[model samples]
Target: MKRWWATVPEIAEDVRDALAAGDDIHAIRMLMDGINALPAAQKAGTLDDALNAPDTTGDPRWDALLAGALRYRLHQIGEHAPSWTFKEPLEKGWWPFAYSPSDAYNDMAHTPAELMRLGIFLDEREFTQA
Candidate 1:
């Protein structure tokens, strides 16, 4: 199956850059809303299974940052946005309903290790544009 959160590093970098450049919630809102509207979901998995997945990637910082981004975005919206919801391709556990990627992202426990392996942390300074 294809990995959904795989693209998060690049997208997160963009979000981080926007946040650092004095972009308020409204600006962040626009960014999030716009991205969420895309045909492809940048991140994947249902809220249930994704939330329960192990962090085999061995990098806590990576997991923390990914989780923080999702949670922060949720806070901005006050609730689940319809565009953020989706279904997990492979059924793992006892989940009957599909989950929102937003929910999966918000859940700290489920941030995949693959997200960390992508080298998103290598250049934190690059996110801060002049």
Candidate 2:
């Protein structure tokens, strides 16, 4: 299933670069802008698609990032509880949700390259701009 983040590679790269530069705020802002810039129909459809897609990818990192991105997006829309106050069921032995536990820990674990890969994977490759 295509995800909202998967549809915007350039924006994802920008966010990853910002994260590498130790500017998480900028990364989050870029993410927010990218989502907001999408047409309303696309945004709604993509969000639903991502949420309903089965967790076929067994990689914990991918799972964590995908879940985090979804949560972050929800937070932006004022749908998620305050400060990302939600706990997803854990796959036994998997690291706790990256964003939770602690901000510092989340940053340490989710490196720029990891985020870049997640972004690339999420991109649906359905449309191109020229």
The best candidate by TM-score is: 2
lDDT of each residue in 31-65, candidate 1, tens digit only: 34433422233233333233232232232332343
Most accurate candidate by lDDT: 2
Q: TM-scores for all candidates?
A: 0.25, 0.33
Off-target runs (Cα >4 Å) in candidate 1 are 1-54, 80-130
Q: Write the per-residue lDDT of candidate 2 for residues 11-95, one digit (tens) a residue.
A: 5556667666877556556655554544442446654432343222234443444444545545545554223223344333233
Model 2 segments beyond 4 Å from truth? 1-7, 40-130
lDDT of 1 at 98: 17
Q: List the residue pairs that clash in candidate 2.
A: 6-122, 6-123
TM-score of 1: 0.25
The lDDT per prediction is 0.34, 0.42
lDDT of 2: 0.42
